[model samples]
Target: MPTKPSVLFVCVHNAGRSQMAAAFLAHLAGDRVEVRSAGSAPADQVNPAVVEAMGEAGIDLAHARPKVLTTDAVHASDVVVTMGCGDACPVFPGKRYLDWSLADPAGQDVRGVRPIRDEIERHVRDLLTELGVETEGVETGGVETETEPRA
Candidate 1:
């Protein structure tokens, strides 16, 4: 059996995008990947709107925390995904990195944040493929995960 890959998603604040990404990762990857998410600056709680949107998609992230990003999280992952962190994210060698330029959902309501949320879902779907997680239904947005390790 192929070994499960470990992944970390990072954002400025763990309240929105990263939370959603982490939720999708956990949902689609299931038992296939060790997934986590953190933020350069974590908020006290998850953005409620994000939680609601994810809930609508049949995923529950109510237990997800807004964790502060640490060097340990970076060291623990083979792949680190960043969104809107620019220069605040840590750098590590011998690991793959991906930057997702999705808009921040900090202040947006569900209607306004849906586009960003959908984009994240698309990216998450593609990421699952990259990690070799088999899943159907691709009505999220547009991103695609890696199917195999890059050659």
Candidate 2:
């Protein structure tokens, strides 16, 4: 079998946006891609809203938590995606980097978090396509949609 490509998503808090993106990628890729997420400044736990939103999409994110970014993570990934957290992620010499200007879902309610959820899903889909992975085609449930929320 071919070695699975790995991806790392980074953000300031790692509690919301990046976590959601990581979950989506893992789900869509279905083991064809290795997905990980971390924050420049780690939080104690993931945001409840993020969990709730993902759960609605039939994705379980309860096992996920905020993690601090490490040099090893950057080195391990075939692709490193960074959110709005600027200057926190180190520039690794040989890894591909992508900056996603995603809105933060830190303090947002479901009404507010909807758009962010949608954006993440879209990005996830595009990413899977780029990686040559097939979409899971599962209903987004209550968690996934096309909307943007305040950060």
Candidate 3:
């Protein structure tokens, strides 16, 4: 890993899972890590439900637009995480790759997207640990826990 590890999140559509994952990493890792996200087949806009779910967590995705996956993106990152993008992502030597078997958030409502968003947060936290990034004292966007009641 480089002094500041660069991570790329990829999926079939850049609208939901990848977007959430990248946001969590960026929020949690801050400037300690470089984060990027893309899709094999990019969506025209971000999923509305995803935006709402992330907003509930206090991280806004309203302005985020889907981006297409590129070979150069894969080459530029130290780690590449794929979420249901399957074989669409290109493989290159010396780049660490991880495939997260996450559900596609397409057409899902905010309630349905909440769990996926939290799950991505967990994974992003683990990834930060693996990359030796410290997350202490970082203010999270207030993701709700299972036992917490929705306001």
TM-score for each candidate, following the candidate numbering: 0.86, 0.89, 0.93
Model 3 residue 5 CA deviation (Å) reads: 0.1
Better of 1 and 2 by TM-score: 2
| lDDT: worst 10-residue window of model 2 | 142-151
CA deviation > 4 Å runs, candidate 1: 136-151
The most accurate candidate by lDDT is: 3
Cα RMSD, each candidate:
7.2, 3.5, 2.1
For residues 1-151, write the lDDT of model 1, one tens digit per residue. 6778999999988999999998788877676789889999899999987887666666777887899999999999999999987788999899899999888888877765666677888888888888777766533323323322212
124-151 in candidate 2: lDDT tens per residue? 7888788888765655553345454322
Task: Output the number of the TM-score-best candidate.
Answer: 3
The models' CA-based lDDT, in order, is 0.81, 0.84, 0.89
lDDT of 1: 0.81
What are the runs in model 3 whose C-alpha is more than 4 Å off? 141-151
How many residue pairs clash in all the candidates, one count each? 7, 3, 0
Model 2 TM-score, all chains together: 0.89
lDDT (Cα, 0-100) at 88 in candidate 3: 92
